[model samples]
Target: MFQDEARFGRMVRIRRCWAPKPARPMVGNGYEREFLYVYGAVSSLQGQFDWMITHIMNTTHMSEFLAQVSSAHRRDFIVMVVDGASSHKAHDLVVPENMRLLRLPPYSPELNPQEHVWDELREKEFPNRVFNDLESVRRQLEDGLPRLAANRASIRSLTAWPWIVSINLNAH
Candidate 1:
């Protein structure tokens, strides 16, 4: 599984919208710095994923999320590829027995396909909108994540890069 995190908040931007050829001025409700963090992981071969929404991104949350993923896939050996975040490398972080983490090279977000999941979430679920509050944003994410999870083909197309496919093929 490829792992990553995304942040969503009251800060909203007006994205492209359908308008006449002479487009009218577009307006957004404004922005706020308050945010929520979403931890996500995706399986390249099957497009399966697990995610958690948290108030903060820290070692505790990472460990908890890892535990959840491990529980969900307890029967299978999991090789989770994650970025070199400080929380991920925290000394107190507890990795599940059946799962191992592989840290991607520093500053290498492009190599982790889980990032695309964030893009999809933002584009489809949060575009051109201002959320009333943190809970409102959470509600939208709660609803949208399952829809994205069910879209196996889109996940596969977004994450199954050539090198990822090669790695999976060689692992077996």
Candidate 2:
């Protein structure tokens, strides 16, 4: 499984919008810097995942998210590929019994498939939009994640890299 966290907030980007050619251009709402962090993991082989949203991303939150993922897949061992965030390597990080973390090389976000999940979330679910508050953003995340999780084919298409597939095959 690949794991990562993405920060989404009221900072809206200008995305393509449709309007009459002679009319005024589309405008995005002003950026407000509030943020919510989403911690997520994807199992490419099974197209399954677990996620959590929190206000902060630190050792404590990381530990909590790990526990959630661990309990969800307690029957199987999980080799989680994650970025080298400080929180991931915190000295006191508590890894669940069923999972272990494998840090990707520094500056290699492309190697982690979970990064694509964040891109999809931002582009598709919350594009060019400003939330009224943190709670609204949280609600969108809550609704959006499950929709993503339920789309197994979409998840597989997004995350099933050939090298990852070969690695899994070799492992088995």
Candidate 3:
């Protein structure tokens, strides 16, 4: 599974949208600094996705998210591909017994399929929208994650690159 973390917040990014010619489109802007972190893992071959929303990004939270993913897939040994985040390499980080971390080379976000998941969420769930509060942002994430998870076909389509599907994890 490819793993990564994303920060979501009340800050809104104005995305391009279609507007009738000669009509000006109004986009709302948000500058609040409040933020939350989401930890996610996607299995491209199986189209299985796991995610957790957290108040902070730290070793403890990373460990907890690992545990959650481990619990969700008790029988499968997960070789999680992750980036070189400080929390990911913390000396005291608790990696679950059924999982192993494989670090991607520095400055290679494009290699992780999990990034496409974030792009999908931002494009679909948060396009041109401004949240009134942190809770509203959280609620949107809560809704989006499961909706994405339930659509196995969509998950596979978004993340299952040819190279990714070709690799053998030896899960048997």
Best model per TM-score: 3
Window of ten residues with lowest summed lDDT in model 1: 163-172
TM-score of 3: 0.95
Q: Which predicted model would earn the best lDDT?
A: 3
> Comparing candidate 2 with candidate 3, which one achieves the higher TM-score?
3
TM-score of each: 0.93, 0.93, 0.95
For candidate 2, write residues 11-129 as lDDT tens digits. 87667767887887756685688999999999998888789999999999999999999999998888988899999999999999888899999999999999888888887888778
Candidate order by TM-score, decreasing, is: 3, 1, 2
Residue 88 local lDDT, model 1: 91
Q: After superposition, how far is residue 7 of candidate 1 from its true place, in Å?
A: 0.5
What's the CA error at residue 14 for candidate 2, in Å?
1.7
Per-model RMSD to reference? 1.7, 1.7, 1.4
lDDT of 1 by residue, 1-172 (tens): 9999999898886688888878786666856788999999999889887899999999999999999999999988899898999999999999999888999999889889999888988999988888778999899989999999999998999888988888743245
Candidate 3, poorest ten consecutive residues by summed lDDT: 163-172
lDDT of 1 at 154: 89
The CA lDDT at 33 in model 1 is 85
Clashing pairs in 2: none
Candidate 3: misplaced stretches above 4 Å? 19-23
Off by over 4 Å in 2: 20-25, 169-172
Candidate 3 per-residue C-alpha lDDT over 23-49 given as tens digits, one digit per residue, 9 for 90 to 100? 988978999999989999999988999
